[model samples]
Target chain A: MHKLYMGNRQKAPGQQFITPSSHSVQFYEDPEVFLEQLAGFAGAAVGAGGCYLVLATAEHRCSLQQRLARRAIDLRMAAAGNRFIALDAREVLTTFMVEGWPNRERFFASLEPQLLRARSARLRPDAPLSAFGEMVALLWEDGHREAAVHLEQLWNELLGRHSFSLLCAYPIACFAHDSRDDLFARVCREHTEVMPTEGYTALQSDAERLRLVSTLQQEAAVVRAVVEERERAIAQRRHAEEKLWRSEEFVRRIIESGVDCVMILDPQGRLEYISPSGQQALEISNLSNFLGRSWVEFWKDEDRPRVEAALAAARAGGIGSFQGDCSTPQGTRKFWDERITPVRGNDGQVEQLIAVARDLTELRQAQQIAVQAEKLAAAGRMAATIAHEINNPLEAVTNFIYLARTTPDMPEEAARHLEVADRELTRVAQIAQKTLGFYRDTSKDKWLHVRELVEDVLLIYERKMRNKQITAEVSVDPELRIYFKQGELRQVLSNLLVNAIDACASGGRIWLRAHASTDWSEGGEDGVRFTIADNGAGMSPEVQKRIFVPFFTTKANVGTGIGLWVSKSLLEQHGGSLRFRSRQGSPSGTVMSFFVPGNANLQVHELPRSA
Target chain B: MAFLSRLLAARAPAREAFPSFSDGPPVSAVRRPHVLVVDDETLIADSVAAILNRNGYDAVARYSGLAAIEYLEKKRPDIVVTDVMLPDLDGVHVALTVRKVLPQTRVVLFSGHVSTTQLLELNSAAANSFELLSKPVHPAQLLKALQPAD
Candidate 1:
């Protein structure tokens, strides 16, 4: 049978200076593999009638027992026959140590009993017994290099007398750096045979194994250096990718969450990237609706030229901005304050345009209201001066009327007419004063006298009627009253009166009448109805049909076309209505009537008109 | 014109409606309290002066604050009623001038403008005793303000 020779010399029985049969093997092997190999060596020696001694930790001892059992060797029977001796290396080392240092005599005393029992159990066996020691490995792991070497030397000395083949193992982690090379060389020199690492052990010849191990070790060092550099490169790439993703995510979040419509347009004004807000501002379902579409298509036809000009400016590497009326998907008009800024490429050419559009619809409406208010302010200022001027003359005329009435010999009827004139002039003064305070919108309602309101309107028309030789007649149900906004009611009455006057020809007759009508309010309360009828050229059927429509005028530029429309609107706002009947041509006339509910302006419900 | 005078005569019985002027010197001459009324509009100034004169105060009219101040240099009026906004000097400036020249002179500033209150505030520091009236000035309120104890 071919035997394993792990070292330079084969083991011989009882040599004088050194054990010819003992081979000192220094190996770097896993503890289990070491155990199995140890078991093989130990079991072979025991089978040859040589005693086996093992000094290892209990874990390795059990592993060795299992391996020996797997090899068909009964380690327990061998121990009972005194052919095998197993001891914990730590316990054995404790017995030999004197104050943390190994004592030679103590080391000899500790092992001699185990060694003698193992040897006495066999005839100077056919072959020397094999022993395995891990105490040096334990010492090396504990960072005591000198003590580990001393233990190895002790094992070598024991080899002289015991004639045992020795196997020793240290974990590969024991000498991990170049600084431990001295200790490494000393450990190798102490052994008769130093086994290469696991990689080169399969080689057939020792010289070839040495050469291949040297080459493989050098190649492994180069491969490790290259692998470390590659790992650093991969780490750097991952870090850069993470940073780029974070920056893109940050910008994406800002653009998506922004209040304005942020969009990126190619230099040709085609939409490239439309932010979430852009889709919302344009009322599109998603960016897909706008992406790759011409941005000018979103603008109103009238606004396209301006948008094209803005895009041209932006393409020229300049900023452009415009305010425009744009419609939503539902075709409702909206105003946008849009701006396009050029994004220049490295070549200094316009690469893209960043369009940020803000919805300015409400702002535009408010600005229109401000302009209207400014116009009203100017009109009010003019009215104030005009009222003041009118009041001055009205006062003088009042005083004149007062003096005329105080005349001793004036006709009684003339005096009576002068008194009426005075009262009407006072009303004129009141109306002028009302104009001065036109901005004051009073919420208070008053019990309105319908007849008195009609009389007031008639008084305003008295001069015009007389100039046109027209006859004005009035018939009223006495004390016809309605509760409402008095000023608005007066305006409705004035509108009807003027419309009747316009319908009348020269020398025509007109009648103004009022009475309490049926319940017409939301609460079904009684209302006051007033009627104005004129015998003159009346409205055509079509004219009467569209009379209340705003801007529907028959009198060419002479009429504002808003009087009837406004009168009807105002009446509706006051919880009332204006309706009429008319016949066209000779002997034909128009009868216009309006009703004010008794409880008008008092209800909590909204009026038809917001104002 | 005759009817206007007749109308004035028609109110002869109510001559003592404002008796503050009678509380002054009671000589046989019946020395009336001289009032100076200033307004940019001649209608307002003359009408106010006429109304005051009808009530027994000897009132004169001036169209500008500077004219009122110029008139103040010659004769010391018992009261100066002026418009707050004048084409020349401001009414508050006239009041301050009155306070500087004649501390005893009473001032009444009347205007139909929103800036009247701001103008009054600017002069209220020195002329706190002056009266402010918004136009169009009612004759009764003017008469009552001229009462001695008022």
Candidate 2:
């Protein structure tokens, strides 16, 4: 019967070599000696030194030939103490050994005749390639009369290397092959072909063939178990590697997601990691240049020592932070908040340092704005105090002058002088009043007439008007009215009138027009609009732009620069607006318009009339 | 009627009967108290003094806190009103010094631009002993502050 080849070869325990004329007698009782001798013969035929054969019960041929060849090489290597490279029969069959050669013809002649005789013999009534066939081959070879004559014509055709196992049935003639013309062949036959039961006794005789075979089978099983164990170990290692990769990914995502710049440095201060926010914070174009560089190299020279100390302290587990100026392309920057935290490993060693930095540029700017506000508030308080001192006496002086002017039978010259004093006192009173208006806390509103307020403001300009020969034209639409604090509106009008009169040189026209303009400045509101225009030396374009700013004026000594500013402030307090327009040179003049919301009549307080 | 009226007329001054600049009514007797005025600038201090005088409580003018304190030693006013920015010791320190001597006297402090909160730890001894007033004080506002409790 043909020994079935399994999918994988079972490696032999160890190789035992017995060449012709060298150690041939030692294999006389062993069957593995026969297997090794046959393998050597096959190897010698193929011009190689190594071969492995696998035998099973002719049913398990599931593995590919390449897989079998790899199995064969592994088995041979193991038997040879992991030292030998085995030849592949499949490689030789597919390539050079089978291609257009004399060896192929000889090989086919030997195998075809043997295969054909076996088929013809199987046609007879006998177990196919069974022990009966082995007995018939031995009987025919031994000169047994009937068998020899009957098997003569088919004997040469039926001989094959695998069919040599038939001799086991004829235990006597098998000795002829073991002690044959070739000593190596004799030793192989004696070692593997001799049956185990055909010994002197059960225990004391040379009957160890079965036990040795069982030992070799157990060794092959142990080798297969080791291979399976290694495979499980490899799978476990792969799983652990995958877990490590995921953990690294999770940490990377957290660092990248941070909003503040996150940087990690190794214990030696070389940058190990830089988060995405670091690129945005530093405004760098490339992230590669930032990593694996000394942190001190990227820092400005002055900040290096400070950062280094912080890093050292953090690494030592004493918490520390660094605040230093960082120079950036936008400005000399202040990095007022930067923290360094040590990353410790399981062994309690400082593994790395992580730094987080937030930019505080807006915080500094907000502080500066608050400081400026405090200063302006202080200045306003001081101005209010000075205005208070001026207002009291100035009020008394106006009353005194008014009383003096009313005296009966006063001489014309003395009355004129009294009139001049009253006018100057009124002028000084206007100054005090305007100053108070500028500094006073605004509260309530009262109705005021545009025409009457204009007349009262023009009284202060009388001397200037007479000196300059300026044409003073007052045209007020009777319907025009305004709502505001009475004194505040008066101050606003006074500032505008004074500015207009001052803008004029000798013999310039001052036009005061009051009307209700719904279409003031194209798209404004329905309001009482007053325009004061002067044909004076008009302002340049530069001066016009800054005309309403505090402390901005063109007149050498006459303008306080704050008049227009204060005027705008007062007008705005009354829910009104002020605007200016001017022509530069030819027919040059300045025109300013104030638009007051026309809710004035509802807020009127009756003024006391003089008797 | 002739001698009696003459003696009465001699004793009585012009502005008010017993219109005394010296030895006027004790400040404690007056329901609404008067703060004696003291400043070197006569224009400023006298204006304040006149406003206080016209408001119907007595006001004695002095140039400095030391003089005001001397006047106060003779006549115990209900309250001592002084400028924080003074020719003598600063008003805050003067208030501190006055509290050491006359602990009963209520001190009303004034300055041009220094806010009360900025000057005094109001929750502490200052708030308990004194009050702050911002200058330049309007006469009506000052007189109203000086109006005594019932």
Candidate 3:
């Protein structure tokens, strides 16, 4: 009986473990344990007058030879007698490998010679020949896993014909990946005897091994539960993060698309973030230039105090708001209804400030338009009433004048005086008729001669201009005409003329000019352009900037503030525009020019044809 | 010119015999068209009535629309000339009433305010039946309007 040496002085099951024609496999992690087992197997074969062959890596082969030398096997004498043969596993694998696979004929052709020589060198022909090979291990390490398993099968087939005991060894590290577990099972199945690594095989007793196995099983269960809990925690965190990201995206979209400007300021009152709409509202092309700047610095100098107060209030964890004017970088004045609210941290202390600004420029203009319309309506009603009241007495006077002129006996000179008086009264009646006409026929569009419209407006303001001792030099084309809303145009012209008259001092000169011209701005449409220039005290630059702003007036209480604004709005409604130039230096004056298109039929429906 | 001289000659006697119509028939064989001048303003009513008399029409003055309507119940005039805006009744109401009372009598309306034109025009029957004149009405224009349609 042949006994295989186990490292712990334990006997493996099954006698004749290294008998002739036997195949075995060893899976090992520790090289020392593997070399001890190999030394035992090979030493027994040499002592039995048998042959021993080794096909392994250089390191393992060198270590095995040294161990055999220590055993006094006399390897040099054994080699001369054709007993011990050692070869590099990689070199031997190359001789039989055909395109990374072991061809059966090449396998026999490469290893049969070595096997026969070792068998024939045996002390007796029937002596046991034991061979150890790590070639399969090398193939598995090189990642030709199929070749390694095929080579194992070929070795089994070769053992049937040869009388040698074969041993295949693999490093436990070769099956490190979980996917190689099936390959490990297959490799074990290919061998008649399979040896586990030292971890299982080195146990002193079966009871001890069983106890260790039970402990390992319990540890594996605990590890699996811990891993599942960790995975659950990680998944919960990911889900919460995804929800947070989605909510942030929703808020970002709202802030980006909203019309109101939203801004965030640091507790120190410096701007930290501005929404996309805020950047547009502030007319900022580059946010970097405005970031970290004091938020109050954007307002006008006169309004800075109020803005600063609001910011301070919000920084103190209170809400503040104001309606004020601020100019953009492009110097366009804008009105903003801005509210500031404090953003607090968990500690209930102010951490940031949020400012939401609603553009009030358009709203303010709309409100002013409504107020001006109401004022104009009231004025129209009053004028109609006054005209109606005056017409009664005027009619009585005209009747008396007619009767006096029709007297049976009258002197020629007296009759001529009465005739003159009657003609004068007719002029008065014409003025009354024109005043009443302003309120009547409000929705009619008609062609108006430039001279006649001018004369009509001048006639109403003639007394005022005369009282001011202002002289108006009128130059107009007699045939210059415009077809538009009569009352609206009349109102515009009246506003301009009245402004000019009011601006002029006593003995001041006013130039009123009208000509048939083309509105080049609107692609050369035939139109009439009127220029009313006054050699009065011209306006300052500040006043000129806000000239068209509703309720921005320089003429304290007497002026209705929205006169020019209403006029401009009315003209714009008719596809026209009004502009002015003024200077305050010597020979300074203001020249206001406005253009009216000739054909306004297309604009008739766009606006109500009334003042 | 002869009619003017005759009117002038009759003016003094006519002034003394003012508001003294016989209520039966005229002393002259030539029939005069009877005219009713209605106005809240006494001066306007009296002057218009006097002018119509001088123009050879038998005209009477009523200072109120109610007084004019009262006068109409007694005598159906050939024409009713009234101010549109009155203290008691608007001229449209008076004109519509006259159309009901005396279907043959023509009504002429005058108003100092232009709004009355819209008011009259809004009432289709009054707009069609009555001719509106804006005030400070000239004597010739009034007389032309008062003339017989034929």
Of the candidates shown, which would achieve the greatest TM-score relative to the real structure? 3
| A79-196 per-residue lDDT for model 1 (tens digits) | 8987888889999888987766678999998887777777678745454556778888888887777888887788778877765577788777677652424787778777876665
Could you give the candidate ranking by TM-score, starting with the highest? Answer: 3, 1, 2
Give TM-scores of chain A for all candidates: 0.47, 0.37, 0.61
Instruction: Tell me the tens digit of each residue's lDDT in model 3 across B1-150.
Output: 554334333432233223345774454654677999898887677667767776668888898878988999999898999999999988888998999999888889998876786687687654455788988787778878877767
Best by DockQ: 3
Residue-level lDDT tens digits of model 1 in B4-75: 555444422224653435566544356667999888877567666666666677889999887888899999
For candidate 3, the per-residue lDDT at A283 reads 88
Worst 10 residues of 3 chain A by lDDT: A1-10
Tell me the docking grade of candidate 2.
Answer: incorrect
Regions more than 4 Å wrong, model 1: A1-44, A50-194, A198-221, A262-334, A337-356, A362-611, B1-35, B50-59, B69-80, B92-108, B121-127, B138-150
Better of 1 and 2 by lDDT: 1
Classify candidate 1 by CAPRI docking class.
incorrect
Model 1: fraction of native contacts: 0.04
lDDT value, residue B149 of candidate 1: 72
Candidate 2 — which residues are off by over 4 angstroms?
Answer: A1-327, A331-335, A338-355, A380-385, A402-421, A439-611, B1-150
lDDT of each: 0.73, 0.55, 0.81
TM-scores for all predictions:
0.50, 0.34, 0.64
| Higher-lDDT candidate of 1 and 3 | 3
